[model samples]
Target: MSKFKKKTGTSQDIPTSALPDIIFMLLFFFMVTTVLRETDLLVEQKIPAATQLQKLEKKSLVSYLYIGKPKNAALYGTEPRIQANDAIISVDDIFRWVTEEKDKLSEIERDQITISLKVDQEVKMGPITDVQMELREANARKVLYASIKKVDL
Candidate 1:
C-alpha cells in the first residue's frame, strides 16, 4: 500500500572462483616440501650411541651397509645378516659389491668413496671383523661407523 516495495530474496551462493587456485597452491606446497625415502631397510637396526660423534661432510660420497638381524625371522632366521644396497648379501659378496660400487663412480671420485656401517647394538664382533677383512682386501680403506650421539645424564 506504500510507495516502497519489500525485497525478500538475496543471493545465497558462495563464490567459488578462487577455490581451484587455492587447491593448486596447496598441491604444489606439499610436492615441494615432502622428502621421499631413498632406501627401504630390510634389516632392523638400532644404532648404538657413541660418546664421540663426527658428522660426514658429503652424503653423496657415502654408501651405506646395514648389519642387523633380519626383520623376516621365519624366512631369514634370527641370526644377524648383512644388507648392502637393497638386498641381503653374505660376507663373501662384500668385495664384489664394493668393486661394482666403485665402478659406478668416476676415477677421481673413487678414492673418496666412504663405506658407512650401520650396525645394530646387539650384534656380535665376529661378523663385523669378517666384513672389515673383506673391505681390506677390496682396498676400500675409507670407513665410517654410523652411531647416534650419546646424551649425558
Candidate 2:
C-alpha cells in the first residue's frame, strides 16, 4: 500500500455549532436597532378609557397632535405649532405628513385621513372641540381619540 493515506474530504466535515452565535448576534443587532413606539408628548393627559375599543382595521392616517394645555399648542411630530397655540393644521397637509409613504397604498387608501387627539383630560373642552371642528372642516373621514389601554402582565 502507498504510504499516503486516503486524501478525500470526510462527509463529517465542520459542524454547524458555530451558526447559532452568528444568528443570535444578528438577532440582537436588529432588536437593538429597531425603533420603539413613541409616547404621547403630553405627560399630563389622562388617556380616556375605552370599554370596548376596536383596533383600527388599518394603521393611523391620523397625524399626531398634542393639546399641550395651559398654553394650548398644536404639537405634531417633533414640531410644535407656536404661532397658533391652538392651530388647526389643514387636513390636506395632515394627509401628506401622516401618510408620507402613500405610493405604498392603493387609491382608496389615499382618501381616508383620520385625526387622533391627545388632549389633556383636565384641559377645557373648547380647544378639544375646536381641534375636532378644524379636522371636520378639512373633511377628515374620522377623528379618533388616543386612550391608554390597561393590560395585565
TM-score of each: 0.81, 0.53
After superposition, the stretches of candidate 2 with alpha carbons farther than 4 Å from their true spots are 1-25, 38-43, 70-107, 149-153
Q: Candidate 2 lDDT (Cα, whole model)? A: 0.56
lDDT for every model?
0.93, 0.56
Q: Which candidate leads in lDDT?
A: 1
lDDT per residue, candidate 2, 1-153, as tens digits? 889898787587788899999999999999999987664343344566665676876664545566543233344443222112134454334434444433445677656755567765666676566556655655555768777776645
lDDT of 1 by residue, 51-153 (tens): 9988788888888899999999998899999999889999999999999989999999999989999999999999999999999999889999999988899
Candidate 1 has its poorest 10 consecutive residues by lDDT at: 53-62
RMSD of 1: 3.2
What TM-score would you give candidate 2 relative to the actual structure?
Answer: 0.53
